[model samples]
Target: MSEHGGDRARAEAWLGQDPDPETRAELRALLDDPAALADRFGAKLEFGTAGLRGELGAGPNRMNRVTVMRAAAGLASVLTSRDDLRESSGGVSVVIGYDARHKSDVFAEDSAAVLTGAGVTVHLMPRPLPTPVLAYAVRHLGCAAGIMVTASHNPPRDNGYKVYWEDGAQIIPPLDQEISTAIDAVGRVDELPRGTDWRVLDEAVVEAYLRSLARLPLGTARDLTAAYTPLHGVGGAVLAQAFAWCGFPEPDVVAEQAAPDPDFPTVAFPNPEEPGAMDLALALGKGRDLVIANDPDADRCAVAAGGRMLTGDEVGGLLAEYVLRHTDGSDRLVATTIVSSSLLRAIAAEHGVRYAETLTGFKWIMKAGTDRDRLVYGYEEALGYSVGGDDGVPVHDKDGIGTALMVAAMAASAKESGGTLLDLLDDQARRYGLHATAQLSVRVEDLSVIADAMARLRESPPGELAGRTVTEVDDLAEGLDGLPPADVVRLRLSDGGRVIVRPSGTEPKLKCYLEVVVPVTSSPEEARTRATGDLTALREAVADALGL
Candidate 1:
């Protein structure tokens, strides 16, 4: 069939089932607009490890009622088809959770209706909560599958749905592809059955989760004051309560951003790592001992200490040391993504803790500590941390709330030692040598540009960088370790420096992750100076190699 004709037919057919007047009108206009039609329907949104994320509008490309319902139906179909999943004393069960993004609540309800109508048992969170809460609930409830409605730190106009398997981690490999296949085969939305029998969970889950938070104390003084913000997200209230319940001083919340607003009026980008996104929190934290922030969904944590907003790598290194300081490294593993700084490896080795590097994301990191290994903590450079519970219950995802609690405790301990978090970082630098890292991201008007750049680099493989010979290049297109294959290229340099370039899994950009290490022979400051100089030159060389 002609692609344009198919788009027109699909749009006309969707109008028959679309219940929202706004979306229906939008689709009707697209039927006559060929370019708009093609843009919306030329390709269906592919469901991968990250699930579905896009702008909110009409048509197949946008996030709307029909797309969510179809995703729910597809997920329901997959879970019910698994014979082992159905053998539960009850029927196949799924848990649904959503954050405070626009249309998130409505999408959650639609999922409940579709899953219940598919003859599967469904449990819905009573309120919009953080992604980690949903991820924790999946394992805590012993459900066969889970869905979280959130875009994490994306802009306000966007929303998404992330799928979790029985392990409570995001779906990977054949599962994501399988769910995509199911979604592709879904019939019209009106033909799908909708029901209201699914269970809506009470505060029991939240109460239990808070109680679990109470057990994570590391003998740190609770004397530290933290300035905090939730970036106009739903995490503010829950996080505040969790800290108070844990007997820590009440954080000074950013009044303007304390409440949940779907528009995210306070920040240009809701992500904490973005420039100026933490300006309000930083301003409020000026006189405080620590500044703590969570991305809109509270699944990621960011902190500023001693008038310095620490990079994600620095926070990760501190947290890794904190975890290792408290526990005997026996049978416990600490992990980070391949793109993250190698400082964690130094700390882990110093404490005799096992360390593993996985493909980016907590899904792979979580598995590294599962079974006999038992992961005590894991983090990524994008401000995501998963601090394992000492009681053997695995969170299996990056948890901002839990990590925030630990960050507070870690800061308090540092204060008790008559120093700050900065002092602790210096101690690590002196022991493990200084590892400085930076990222070069090229946001493109066309995604094809990223593809072309990656192809060119692969074909012409640079032999040198920053006056140093390039020792090795691993074209990760084929796969690495036992982890799944990904479209990434990694470069190893002679001076203990490294670089990895890959297309972002979620955003439309090519990201270059660069890191360099220098020995701390003279002083911590000298080590930083040397590493910074080396990194700047490396950045230019890398940019030249990618023709950026």
Candidate 2:
């Protein structure tokens, strides 16, 4: 049969099983357009460690009810099959949460129905909430698993499903594979049994999560002025409540972007990392002591201070220092991804704390510290931070609300000392030798473009970057320092700079992480200028090497 004929057959089959009439209409609308049909039904959206994330539409290649129901059934199958977990947990249970995204609530409800039908007790969040709340719920309710419906920083047209195991962290390795295998075995979504036995939880869970924030070692300093925006997400009310509960002043919220709007009309992309996403917040925060922004799910945080938007590495370093200062560092662990700045290692050494560098995801970062050492803090370069305070991680995931509180406390303390976050950053630069970091990300319309770029770099590695000789090349695919094999390439420069090139797992982009460290000889400003220049050169050289 012709490819179009095959797509038609698949589309007809999918339309029959798809329960969402909107998606069914979508499929029918594309029936006459072979190209559109091919786009919708050409390939199934792969369910990997990140779970399912794609544009919202009909067919298996998109994020629709059929795809979500299959994934939920697969998750139910995995939970049911895990006799060890079931026995230990007493019963199979799950907590579901969602953000204010298109079809997010629908997906969450459908998932709950599927899990409930499979004899799994489902405790669903009463309304749209942050991802961290659900992560906290998994452990708070003692459930076997948790599911969150969000695309988290993706475009407005996109949505996603994130799965967390009993550990409250995102799934990794065998579990992701196991769930994927079960999803593949799913025959028909319409045939899957769904139950209305799931329970809609009350504000108790949200209150519990907020109460846990009291444990954050934020010193008694509530005299901090700040501007905040949730980027048209569900974090606004919860974050405001968290601030009140934590004794900090309620932040001056950006009214336009405060409410949960699925279309995210203000920003082109609801991600704070994207350029101009924080423009409104920055404008509102012009004279404030600090500015904070959270993505659509509020799992990741971004900060702005001293008339500048702080890089994720900068925030990670600051938070690491703040956390270590408050905690007994003898047994605690601080970790960051391999793509983050090396400054965390230096800070960890100075603080006498264990530090780990994991592969590029929070999945690996959360699993950094052992049961003995326990993860006190973990962060990645994408504005994701998990701060455990002196105790243990309340939310075993990146928590923007908690991080924002810490930032506020830190800013308040610095203010009391006649300094600002910028001054503290200078102090760190002076002590840690100005560890500057930057990223060169290239978004692509074609997946093959990213693949070709990686292949080109791997085939012909750069001999040097930024006038410095390449001292060492570590093809991360071969595994580095006991890390699992990943599609990444790291190059060490003679001047102690480094670059790591890899494809973004969550988005269609090739990302290159660049860092250049310069010792503060004369002043931190001078060192920063030198390091910035070196980073610019390195960025260009990396772009050239990648043939971008």
**What stretches of model 2 exceed 4 Å from their correct place?**
444-456
Query: How many pairs in model 2 have backbone atoms within 3 A of each other, for residues 3 or more apart or on separate chains, i.e. clashes?
Result: 0
- Cα lDDT of model 2 by residue, 175-224, tens digit: 89999999999889788888998999999999999999889899987788
Tell me the alpha-carbon RMSD of every candidate: 1.6, 1.5
- Residue 425, model 1: lDDT of 87
lDDT of 1 by residue, 85-139 (tens): 7776777889999998999999999999999999988999999998888888888
lDDT, residue 489, candidate 1: 93
Per-residue error (Å), model 2, residue 99: 0.8
* Every candidate's lDDT: 0.88, 0.91
Candidate 1 clash figure, as a count: 0
